[model samples]
Target: MTYSGDVTPGGAPAVRELSGLTVSKLSVGPMDNNAYLLTCRSTGDQVLIDAANEAPRLLELIGGDGLDAVITTHRHMDHWVALEEVVAKTGARALVHADDAEGLPIPAETLTEGDTVPVGDCALEVIHLRGHTPGSIALLYRDPAGTPHLFTGDSLFPGGVGNTDKDPERFAALIDDVERKLFGRLPDDTWFYPGHGKDSTLGAERPALPQWRARGW
Candidate 1:
């Protein structure tokens, strides 16, 4: 039950602390999906992204701390496998974009582009980026020191954008949204936390934009 340990089994090995925000990442489920817990240190208010799987393990991570909300980045099953149980146990509200609400097992509050999700004193600004899913969204938080932290569901990754339909139009739309909504607006030092893998910064992925566009994937 200690805070911030990097090398323990079933524990979040990768932890990042900034301002009053603390992010702990755990790889869960058969797909090895990444679930994140964002906590506001000042008020102890917390939010979780992608419950994915292993409810017991997730409950362990929660460690009796009350959760404010459990947000589903998209409608994909892999991202929500443990959502129902977690929500039931924690009494946390489920939040998802309106476009993908019907896909969830239980009811969810509507979330749209430009909305703000309150986490204690912190406000997580929403950015609805389409193509990976009609409702795919990312959350942005600017810490006290002016550093930006982004939670980019499955629409973006370290190397390129998320998996998309084979249709050329679908691929084009995703790339365009990512370029305009993410790369074009965010700063180079912005740290992004994705749904299923390693974290990456805007600076690391900026240079590959053109290459990704050319590949059309």
Candidate 2:
């Protein structure tokens, strides 16, 4: 079924129609965190990243067909609040980092760096980016046409970085990882779908690395 449009109380789920898939960016809850639904355009198989709040609306989006999997970027409540309900409703397996796995309300398959998750014909490689939380991860997948896409939760944003107030050391490490593992390693053309704001490219954020490091945030 085609998504009608964004629903109220939460910003509309802005659907980005890609080559072989459709990504719906749904802004939910008090923090206005962005949750996404990546579905294969031809097969309709889907994987949801984060649940945030707005359980009712998210349920509507998932509809009757069960979700392939539910991936949590980290363990924060703002990003995972509706996870249990979504998992129960769709019977989808919850996947989270090994460090954050213990904190999830429901059981989840612990994902570590280098593991791959399949959604339809696409494979998402788990990249451990440990700044937002100890187990924070970003999923890197390629579209049918072989274009790279990175789903970075709160670890990295358009111009901002994930809040590191909880653990300064971890945050510092996370920033370094983003630079070395993400920005430095990924292809320049990779599409970055951040957790909070507008989508950016690896090339777009590369130049600002110096500024990010200097700001010390």
Candidate 3:
């Protein structure tokens, strides 16, 4: 099946297979949080993005492969509701941005901009995006034979950036960081998966940057 990136809570997950990596995305929790299970095709090394909620379902996705680590994009409760459970079950290393680590239910190793987290033979580069939260991050996986794939937490979405709680400074910080760190560096074909709802490419949303900025969301 084609990877639509349209997943609903209690519905089936959407999957995308690349040259050396395979990503399976499932939505869980009342907030419809999206959790991604990344498997390195070569070494079968697996990593999960956002434990979110529904520990049993998330565990089912892991099966016998076993998880190497779980990366929490931010410290938001909806993003880590099942984090403690998932970590305890898999014994996977919990990683979060330095600023958000203090807010987590459990202790986590901190991540910062330019840092790389290894998944078997593959690695994800961390991009710290502030505003929605002090240490919000986006993970970038540049497939050798395919286009770039990004896992953006609540910092980015299809229509606009994440909620900054109506603060001008925070809104400004978020949009600027997103434009500079993401749009400025990545190509139009880069596919990004947001925290909730459907996914979209940077090209599709690029034309509306000015509008999103003007509205101050």
Question: Which is the leading candidate under TM-score?
Answer: 3
- The TM-scores of all predictions, comma-separated, are 0.94, 0.91, 0.99
Write model 3 residue lDDT over 1-217, tens digit each, in one string: 8899989899888989989899999999799999999999999999999999999999999888899999999998999999999999989999999999998999999999999999888899999999999999999999999899999999999999999999999999999999999999999999999999999999999999999999989
For model 2, give the RMSD to the true fold. 3.0
| Residue-by-residue lDDT tens digits, candidate 2, 1-217 | 4443343346667787778778888878677778888887778889999987888888888877669999999998888899999988888889999999987888899999999987776668999987778899999877757568899999988786788985668667988999888877878888888777678888878888888877778
Model 1 lDDT per residue over 7-104, tens place: 33354547777788888888885887888888888899999988988888887887777999998999999999899999999999999999999988
Clashing pairs in 3: none
Which candidate achieves the best lDDT against the true structure? 3
| Number of residue pairs clashing in candidate 2, backbone atoms closer than 3 angstroms, sequence gap of 3 or more or interchain | 1
lDDT for each candidate structure: 0.86, 0.83, 0.95
The alpha-carbon lDDT assigned to residue 26 of candidate 3 equals 99
- Per-residue error for 177 in candidate 1, Å, reads 0.9
TM-score of 1: 0.94
Which candidate would rank higher by lDDT, 1 or 2?
Answer: 1
Candidate 2: deviation at residue 39, Å? 0.7
